[model samples]
Target chain A: MTNYHGQWLKLSPVAIIYFAVQFVKDVGNNLIYLLPAILVGYNQFSENGLVIISGLSALLLFVAISALLKFYFYQYRLTDGRVQIHSGVFQKNHIDLPFERIQNVRFEQPIFYRPTNHICMLLDTAGSSKLEAKIIALPKGVAESLKQEILSHKTEQVSNAENEQPEAEHEQILNSRSVQDLIIHGLASNRIWIVLGALAPFFNSLSEKFIAGIENLGVDVDALMASSQYAFWQYVLFFLSIAFIVIAFMALISVLGSVITFYDFKLTRSNDRYIRRNGFFTRHEVVMKLSRLQMIVYQQNWLDRVLQRVNLKFEQLGASLDRQSAGTSGGKIMVPSVTQGEANDLAADAWPENKLSAINYHPVSKRLAVRNTLIAFWLLIPLSGVLAYFGNGELAVASITLFILSTAFIILSWKRWGYAIDDNFIYLRKGLIGVNYRCFPIHKVQQTKLSQSWFMRRFKLCSVKLVLACGGQTLPFIKRTTGEKYIDTCLYQVEALRKSWM
Target chain B: MLADKFSNQSIKPDSLAKVSAQQFTPLSRAYVKVNLMCRLVFWLIVVSVLLVLYWQPWFPLPKMVALYLPQLQLAAGLFGLLSSTYGVIADKNKGYAIRQHDFSYRSGVIFKSVVSQPILRIQHVELKHGPVDRHFGLANLEIYSAGGSMHTFAIPGLPEEKARELRSYVLTHSDIAEND
Candidate 1:
């Protein structure tokens, strides 16, 4: 590994392809706006062949020129204790971050960079999490050396620095995901349904058009449905098969996503820092610092519970969890479909006191269940009353069943609310059917708030909210006195430790 | 489980120095006047704009809509006045305390909250004043910690000089922020 000696250098010319891919990915991510624009522009484009061709070419040329310009302007230099970046063609921006502030130096190898053996380096700062995300198209070996240089430089700063490089640099393979594990992870996650729900309106109109088209073909679909005299058992079997197919389809989509995104998922530890390497098309290698970690989230969905697997997320002290790395290249360290014991060990590595599997959690007050069920009771009246007024007994039964299920969910949610505290870490467990476990150090709490509504005040209940850098966690329906006690304890730890989490 | 070991400690909640909102100092009454004045000016402008829109001949409304324009304007005005009245009442309940170790602000008339940020977490302080606020010698002091924007809360209606003093105090006292 050779030093740059402060010489400013441009990236490999292959970076142009990386930029083009990035441009397409960015556009693909904004499909909501793009879809409508395409719809509105479709009529105009359909009117003329030449106009459509020219418009598409204009878009392509714009992307190409911009990508080329971006690559041309982007320059970087590695010097002692600092990394300088020169980028932004129009804006003419320059950024220099000290080694200590560069929280992570990750090596990313997108699909296009595969042939050339080049990697895109992502430098993450605590506050400006993604603005200075890329220093693209370095040779793979060069990127590795650069990462080591930054990490080692960071170690030489303060003696008690949280990111101090460990003595033995021997790398240890902490965990690896199998194909079966990946499939289980896919089966457990419900993101596909969420996407389907988002696209429901689009699908609704498309479905109506499709049905009209079929009617135009003289298929007599409604008559065909009326003519069929299927037996009750046959109908039940048909519905069960349909349910199985839908579930299988969902699993297929999720499994495909998991395969492409986390094909060879591995979590390895070296010199007190953790590195996650995975993805098929784009070989992603994310380095996570020992210091900046704020929370570990253990997730188990209903399917995951049956399969005895959990999704573990090692969160850092910056971006909120909603914008977490799933489809996007965010700094989310997720190891999905691991055994509970494995998840427990991974969590304990960061926070030694986080014995999540065996922690004795105190359940939230039962009044939560009572209050929620009572609140839900109001919906039952409307659910039945409106349909019953319309003289629909079947609809009434369905609504009644729905109400019962919702009540059960509310009770289960109340039962799931639990929290445990050790000397250093505060572990919170919550869910309905499936469970989620989150734990963070006491000192990581930036602020603690106690809030109460009028009804809660009357019931002597309140919610305690702990604000960490990554996100806020709320403990709802705790006793007012207990909420205050939590606030006191959290503030005491925060002030006493006075440690910088980021 | 370790829950059994803490059974003895459960007899009494650790009598930590109880920091309560009851100890908070009520905001200066001038905040009510300042807020009311701002609201009054706001509603006045809103009414004026509605009147202009109603009487303006360039873009005329349909007969049915025009017939009810005065009523709509009156409703909006009444609503704004009512909200201002509520705001005045809410201002009375707003209190703040700058303690030795932390800063606590108690707010919200209906959904009450007591938020405390440790001094060690204070990242930055901002004191802002608009034209109306300047005229009334008031400033809004916002303190932010090293977290999401939700971790920060704004304290509105501080006297200009007091706001400056508080800003200086926080800047000098936040040793952790300074180190960062």
Candidate 2:
């Protein structure tokens, strides 16, 4: 073996944008805050030359500070057996990671780091239980070689005596969904809201300008307002038209955005890991291992349930990316969309023998649903009456329409809420728009609670919630008497189980 | 079979040496002190709001006082007497035991919770001593599990020496690496 020492660098297009955006944001924020001071100091400037010198000095200082920070706190080294990082100027923190414990590794070069050939290496390890994410600006080939070395088989394992098991048969080298699947997923999604978002500004501007132009004309404003206020047909036509146009525009934008973002969405399986590569302009690569998965969630909304499709998300092993990663969908490895049977089959493939049971759960009956619908109707009646009065009965149609819609909503809400239990798993299927079939292993359930609210108690209904090590799942609005009995039995069984988990 | 035993053997070393039954000596007059503080704070807020709202020179003090007198007394009584009992009961119901092989805790009054952890799986053992607990010659033992966010479990009111011994015993007995 030779000691290969070289300066390595590579970056993605995303890195370039990220760096430029961050730099611009930092400068803009400071400049905005310092505007008053800068203006006040303007009078003290003797000449243009002095001002220019001062600006140049300040710019040089800023660049020097940034570069110094980068130089001092950005150390990375890849040895034969492990990766080493000694960073931070003040405290000098060090991280030593062995190759054997490394579960999954990924190379990302955001557009900002692209020009410098700097790549970010996110390493997931079995121990330390940390993501072990770091940025290593290395040559493309060297970065790839380091990843390969960590992933490569070793002769040392052969002599270890305990490493005699043959390689996994189902350890896939590469697997991905077709472009057709992505297209279907995007089309089926409820993304019509984006077009509305795009059109909102235009509509707002138009309305403001129209109102201003009318005011400028100086006609009898009060009489015109009174005429329109009493005109029932005009009011109905005007509001409805606006609503229809906005919804249509939103639908168009949402459809276009989805198509471009997930154009070639793909997920590949390699050895002990799964890699998800998606997004056209800003490509994102997420790598995760099988063992790190605490649980696999298959969910569907009402739309998905009716369409017989489910979404898969994996609960990974660690501190869960903190709050900042919430915008990135909580860092969960989502397998986008699949049919109900396909979702089950995929879970089975991931965890071979485990499958969900079909022990039908009794949901909150039609009686409760009707009661809820009546409550909603009564609550909205007063508001609707007030609106109807204000608009001279033009709004009466709106209230009647809402009352009619509530009937459908009440039935849908009740129908979507259900759960199933098996010897090894608990499955909760709920939601109206994007249905979710959440399954958790019985052994993984940390605790269970059966709660009754005043409204639910009156209707003889209760909610049962199960807490797990990774996350929580709830089966809401179950018949109180039956729900209590079911919870008691489950608790007893859980207590009796020989193995202990908490 | 040999490999299982080998791994298991490496995990549990001198298990009996670390096993102990601890009888926690409950906090004494600290309960009364806390109760008094709570009552004082509660009354302060109530009186301040009343004074601010009804600060009129024309109105007689007795009349204004009589209006809020019953509610104020009820709040004060509830704070003074009921809170200490709640705290005592909460403390009494929580107990845990640790051995070289494993640790188990029994908690909660209605919905009981019991957590048990094997020594080999523990990522690290922390001995924390706060000012209040230090004055009472008490230390809390925390055990962190691997790859889980809610991994840390704390058992309070252990003697400092015992906490140190437990930490050392676990370190020596468990084969798991302390990476974090």
Candidate 3:
């Protein structure tokens, strides 16, 4: 690719659509206030539709004008060593991101814009600030060529310093999930709960809508309620019906959401980077360098265990603080619904020095179960007494059930909690119903802390927390001696390793 | 699975000499005086405000509270002064150990804890001085990592000159390009 250096270029005209979409999103977010204003205006001037229409048109015009102004101001240029972006309507922001500092480059193309051959390119840097440089709606060819140019420069620099030849650009498909696999993943994941929780706020409005629709059909709700002096069994049946409908709705949404987000999910490795492409309406191409990966987490819920599947997530250096940016593939790479063997193979490919097969995890102290059970018992006893005092037999039964289940979980977690440290990597296994096996190079650890609580001090036990660039993980209820040794060894490795953590 | 061939080595806790054996440098003794002065001023202001509220007619006071307000204020002031004095003494015990490869900070009055971070992992260093600290000619040094709630480590009450020197040393030694 030839260099088009120092040319200040505007985004493709199709970026107008992106800006328009952003405008619509902003309007949607302000709907919480806008809806009430419209309602109040309607109440004030009962049948004045024109007033409401004019107000809405005014709002739309404001959004469109602002979006256009933003599009007019945004410009980017590719210089010799850095990509410079000039944006912000009022603040006049300028950002210069060197190619070497770029941790990952991602390309996204919405299905509607595919015919125009336009793509959104995002560049991430390993910094505390969550600012990402994004170029929206660039011609697909231009985006691809520019990405290649920057990446080639980065690879050239790395290879020149290391005095080694760059690897051939041969893409290898590590794993691809089938429709069946997606369905299993959807079932195994907790998306249904999340969707249900999100919908909780709108439940009252949904029910109101339903009742209004019934009333519009001329049903006498009051009379029906008065007539139905339901028996115990009939009430149970009615409640069960509502629950079944809600569960079925949530399940459908969860399945559709997962399928849409992860359709044609494919993981491929090219040189020292792993590229993932997925999603249906909006295609995402995420690139993750092997060196930038901080940890590999193998997670398995009870459903996943039953299905003999695991979800592997590769966390990178920095966390995406903004919830909006989380939608884009930046901070972490997830491979959903893969077999254990495939997960191991991928981990090995990513970090060959760490022998996952040879890991011998030492379990945490057994007394952890006793301590946890005692704490649970103490808390649950009072909770159960309160429920009994309230004369709520159903809630009392539920609380007892929860107490028993938690006791079992505590025991199971105590049995599963373990850690293993080899010369190169540290592996930590923890969970109850869902087990997570997290492993990272010892050298990547930023900090280590050995803490002893009053209870742990009594038992001559301590917990060790390993802080990474992304976050910290704890191995609890270990003998103080072992915890200190692990911390010391990890510290030594972190200091001795010459390679950068990122 | 090679779980059977794993050799588990157990070392005595006391035998681990890395952080324990390293001598730590305590904060400037004047820091205690600074803390004491700040605490006293803060408590004095709080007590004065409370006394004004009790005596002033702007706010309606309950009859019972008005009856014993002066006594209550006296007891509260005494308690505040004593606790602040104790707190200053306790903070004096806080110390930091800077090793060749890492730095450890030990703090706490009742439950002591030692947190160590590899020098290579430090993202940035900051020296901050508040009004009270400026009055005392002291500054606080904060070290942060790439991600977390707040600073990975903070050492309060260092002489301003020493703080600046340490900050420069950290900035010079930290290799940002290696991480990039």
The native-contact fraction of candidate 1 is 0.71
True contacts kept of 3: 0.42
Model 2 per-residue lDDT at A21: 52
The lDDT per prediction is 0.82, 0.59, 0.81
Better of 1 and 3 by TM-score: 1
What residue runs in model 3 are displaced by over 4 Å at the alpha carbon? A1-3, A32-48, A128-131, A199-231, A320-329, A353-360, A366-416, B1-17, B62-86, B149-151, B172-180
The CAPRI class of candidate 2 is incorrect
| Candidate 1 off by > 4 Å | A1-3, A30-32, A36-65, A160-166, A212-219, A228-243, A321-329, A378-405, B1-13, B44-78
Indicate the DockQ of the complex predicted as candidate 2. Answer: 0.10
Clashing pairs in 3: none
Tens-place lDDT per residue, model 1, A173-227, is: 9999988888878878877998788778688666676788889999876875566
In terms of lDDT, the poorest run of 10 residues in model 1 chain B is: B2-11
For candidate 3, give the DockQ.
0.34
Among all windows of 10 consecutive residues in model 2 chain A, the one with the lowest summed lDDT is A5-14
Q: Write down the RMSD of candidate 1 (Cα, Å).
A: 4.6
Clashes of 3: 0
Docking class of 1: acceptable
DockQ values for all predictions?
A: 0.44, 0.10, 0.34
lDDT of 2 at B101: 47
Q: What is the TM-score of each candidate against the true structure?
A: 0.88, 0.65, 0.87
